[model samples]
Target: MADQQDELRALLKDSGEPTLERAIAKAREMVDRLDNVTLNIAVTGETGAGKSKFVNAIRGLQDTDEGAAPTGVTETTMEPTMYLHPTMPNVNFWDLPGIGTPKFKAETYMKDVKYQNYDFFIIVSAGRFKENDMILAKEIKKKKKNFYFVRTKTDLDVTQEAKKGETEEQTLQKIRKDCVENVRTLGSPSVFLITSENLARFDFQELVNNLERDLPDNKKYALVMSLPVYSKESLEKKYNTFKKAAWAVAFASGGIAAAPVPGLSTACDVAMVVPFLIKCYYSFGLDDGSLEKLSKRVNKPILEEVKKSSLVSAIADKSSLATKIAAKLAVAGVVESVCSLMPGAGSIAAAGISFVTTRSVLLEGVKELHRVAEKVIEMAELK
Candidate 1:
C-alpha cells in the first residue's frame, strides 16, 4: 500500500502544474472566441425610413442615388435584402424593407426578417420611433439581440415649407429642429443621430466603435477598416488599413521571402502600389473636382494647371508621373527593407537605408500632399 501510494504521488507531480495551467489558458481562449465571430446589423423602419441612404452611409458612399431605398408611403421593399460588406464578407449590414407590414405585427416582422441571424437591430425612423418601433425593440431585447435606434433625414425640409425667403441651409436647420423634437417623443435609451448619405461622415464611426469595442481584437480591427473616410481620424485609420492590406497582398503573392527566381514580383509590387496611389488621389479629390480647383489656385486660365505645353516643363527640369512614382516607390521600399533585413552590418545597412529613404520619401509625399491639400482648401473657401 505504501509503494502504491508513492507511485500515485509521482504520477501526480509529473502532470500537475502543466495540466492545470493549460486548462486555464484554454478557458481564457474560449472566453475570447465567444466574441470572435462576424456581426450582422439589420436596419429596418417604416416606409421611407431612409434605409437605403443609411446603407450607403455605412459603406462610405458619397452619393445617395445608389443608396436611397425605394421610397414610398407603402410596401416598397418586398423582402429582406442582404448588403454584405463588399470587401469584408464576415460582416454584412442588412436592409429590411417596410418593417410595419400591413399583415405583419412588429413581433412577427422580426421573424420575417430572420432576426435570429443578426447580431443587432437598428430600427430607423425618419421622425420618431412609433408604437411599432418600440414593440420591435422590446421583442428583440427579450430574444437577446442588441438593438439601436437611428433617426435619419434631418437634411431636408421639415414642416410643409413654401420655399419663401429662407436659404437652403435655413431649410436644413428647420428640418433638424423637427427631427430632434420627434425623437424626444419616443424616449428610448438607445438612440443615435445619422444621415443616410453621410453616415460615415458623421456619427457612423462612433456607432461602429461602440459596437466593436467589446469584440475580440481581430473582429474589431476588421470592422473598423470597412468604415468610410469622414475625418482625419478615419483617414489615419485607413492608412493603417492600407498598410495591413498591402502586407497581406504581399504575403498572398507567395514566397517573395526567398528573393527572386526570375519572377514578376516587381510588377506585383507596382500593382500593389496602385491601391495606395488611388487612395491618395481620391483623398485629395484629384480625380474629382480637384483639377478644376487647381485651375482656380493659380488665379489663371483653367488650362494652366495641366501644363499646356511639355516643352515649357522641359526647360524647368520638372519630372513626369513615372519618374515621380518610381522615386517615391524607391524611397518607400529601401527604407522599409533596411529595418527588415538580417543582422549585424545588415542592421547598420538597414539603419542607413531607412534614414535616407524615410527622409526623402516623407519630404516628397508631404510636399505633394500639402500642395494637393492647399488646392482643396482653397477650393473649399467661400466664394
Candidate 2:
C-alpha cells in the first residue's frame, strides 16, 4: 500500500495535476477512453482461405460457439459480416466477402464493404499468396489503411509434409519461402503463417505483436485485453496491460464521490471494480468455459488445478450466481478477506478508501489471476 501510494503521488506530481481532484478527473477520463475505444478489424480473402476461422480464433471462439462467425470451406460470407468479440463488443471483426468471386471485384469490394470503417485489414490465404490477394493488398494500400497478410492452415501443411518424412521446421521454412517469393512484388511484406486450430503453435503471437505495434494506444489496450491467453507470453502481455491501467481504474473508482458498495463497509465503486476484475478473469482464461475447453484439448483436469487459487474460485462462484444481487453479495463476502492481506486494509471505509488501497486491491487481484493463468499455460505445456 505504501509503495502504491508513493507511485501514485509521484505520478500525480510528475503530471503537474495541481490537485487530487484534477488527478482523479484525469484518471476518470483515461478509464472512460479505455472502456469506449473501438477497434474494427477487416478480414478478407479468397473462398476457403480460412477467413472466418481466423476471425473466430482471434475472437476466442470456436466455430460452433453460439455467437461465432460461421466457418466453412465455401463462401460462408456472402457479404461483409460483422462478428463482435463475445466479451469485448467494442472490438469487432468484419469477415468480408471472398475475393475473386464472379460477383465481387477487387476494385469495388472496398466501397461495398465500407472500407473506411475498419482500423486495419487482415488478408488471409490458405496456400501461396494468390493474384487476388495481391490485388486486395494493393487496393487496401491505395486507401491508406494498414493491412497484414496471414497464411492460414499451416498445421495441415506441416502434417502432410511430416508424412513425407520432412521435419516441421523444414516444411515451415519451405512454405514461408514460397509465400515470400509469391509476394516479393510487394517489397517483402511480413507474411504470418498460422493455424486457426491452435493459435500457440505458429506465428499468431507475432501477428498480435505487430498489431500491438501498429495500433493506437487506446485501441491497443482494447486489443490486448480482448485477446485469448493462448500462451505464457500472451498472458504476460495482458498482465502488463492490466497492471499499467490499475492506477487509473483505482483512482476513477475510488475518488471522493464514489458510492459505497452494497453490504460492504468499503466506499469504493464496486461497479467499476467488479467489471474490471471480471474482464481480467475472462481475459486470463480463468473462467469455467475456457478452462473446460482447455482441459478437453490437453486431456487434463485444468479446472481443478486452477481453482486452487482462492481468488479464482471466488470469481467462478460469483460468475455462476443468478442475479446481480447475489453476485455483489458474493463479492462483498470475499473482498475483505482478499484485501485483509494488506496492512490497515480492514480499517478503510468505503468513502474513505485511499487510492493506494484501491490500487493495491486491483493489482493484487490481477496478479493472482495472472499467476493462475501462467500455471494453466504451464500445465498445458503451452510455453
Maximum-TM-score candidate: 2
| Tens-digit lDDT track of model 2 for 295-329 | 87779888888877766776777653223432343
CA lDDT of each candidate? Answer: 0.50, 0.78
Residue pairs with backbone atoms closer than 3 Å in model 2 (clashes): 266-350, 267-350, 267-351
Clashing pairs in 1: 338-350
Off by over 4 Å in 2: 1-5, 14-18, 261-269, 319-353
TM-score of each: 0.54, 0.86
Worst 10 residues of 1 by lDDT: 255-264
Q: Give the winner by lDDT.
A: 2
Q: Report residue 98 deviation for candidate 2 (angstroms).
A: 1.7
lDDT score of residue 370 within candidate 2: 84
lDDT of 2 at 70: 74
